[model samples]
Target chain A: QCSLDSVVNKRIQEALKEYKPSIPTKTLSCVSITSSGRLSSCPAGMVVTGCACGYACGSWDVRGTTTCHCQCSVIDWTTARCCHLA
Target chain B: QCSLDSVVNKRIQEALKEYKPSIPTKTLSCVSITSSGRLSSCPAGMVVTGCACGYACGSWDVRGTTTCHCQCSVIDWTTARCCHLA
Candidate 1:
C-alpha cells in the first residue's frame, strides 16, 4: 500500500523547493519639498507637502534661510519647494 | 508692529498650500509561480512558492487538475505555478 503521509510529505518538499516568489517589477519612490525648494526629510506626521502634506508633532525644521514659520505637506519632496531668500 | 502669531499663521497657510508629497517613482511588482504553473492568490502567511513561498493553515487549494498536496509562497502571482494535469 502507498504511504499517504510519505507521499504527501515528498510532494510538499518538492513543491517548496520548486517555488519562486515574485517581486515588484517597478520601484516605489517618493519626494519631499519645503516652502523654499526640496528637502531631505520633513517634520513628523507632516507629509512632504502639497501631494499629502501636513504638520508633524515632532520633527526637525526644514533647512533654509527664511524666518517664515510655516510648514508644508507635499506628495513628492523631490520637487517640493525648499526655501526662498527675500 | 508685526504680530508674530499672524505672520507665522499666514506663512504656515501659504506653505501648506504650496506643498506637494512624493510617490514611488518605480512600481513595486512581484510574481507568483506554483508547482504546476501560475495561480491567483495564495494562503495567508505562506508567501508564493520559489521567491518566498510558504504554506498557510487556512486557504483554498490552488486551482488545477492535480491532487498534489503542497503549498507555495511566491512573490508575484502573475507567473507563479498554477497546477499540473497528471
Candidate 2:
C-alpha cells in the first residue's frame, strides 16, 4: 500500500511540475498616490516604498508602512510610491 | 480506463490543493539605494519605484526603470527606492 501511495505521489508531483507553466507568474506592481499637503498614503493591500514632496523637499519618512510624511516645513504636495505583488 | 484516468486526475487535484498550503507566499520587498552625487541605481531583479534627492531637492526622475536621477542643480545625493516580489 505504501509503495502504491508513493507511486501516486510521484505522479502527482510530475503533474504539478507540468502545471507550473500554466500558472501565471506574479510580478511587482507599483503606483504613486499623491495627495495635497504633506501626507500621502497607499491604497489598501499596497505598501509605501518611498515618497516625493513639493517645494524641493528631500526629507521624508514612512508612517504605518503605508503613508509618506514629508518633513520639510513648507510642503504643498506629497506622493507615496506604493507597491505590491500582482 | 477512462474512469480510472478520471480517478487519478481527481486525486491529483486533491493533492495539489493540499500542496498549495506548503507553497511560500510571495510578498513585496523593497530597499533604498542611496548614493552621493546625483544618481543611484537599484540592484539586479529590482525596479525603481520612486526617488529622493538630497539638499532639499525633490525634483527627480527614474532612468530606464532602475536608476534615479536628481534634477536639481546642486543636488548632493540620490536615492532609488527599488522593489521586487520575493
**Model 1, residue A1: what's the lDDT?**
29
**CAPRI verdict (incorrect, acceptable, medium, high) for model 1:** incorrect
Model 1: lDDT to the true structure: 0.30
True contacts kept of 1: 0.00
Q: How many clashes (backbone N, Cα, C below 3 Å) per candidate?
A: 85, 0
Candidate 1 lDDT by residue in tens digits, B9-56: 455455545545443443112223333322344433323321112222
lDDT by residue (tens digit), candidate 1, A1-86: 24644554555555446544333343223334444322444333222211112232111122222111222333223222221111
Chain A TM per candidate, in order of listing: 0.35, 0.77
- Report the number of backbone clashes for model 2: 0
Give the per-residue lDDT digits (tens) of candidate 2, residues B1-86: 45655677798877666664345678887777878899999999999877777778867888899999999899777878777777
- Pick the TM-score winner: 2
lDDT, candidate 2, A1-86, per-residue tens:
77666666777777877775334578768899999999999999898888888887886766676888887789999999888988
- At residue A57, what lDDT does model 1 achieve? 13
**Which ten contiguous residues of candidate 2 chain A have the minimum total lDDT?**
A16-25
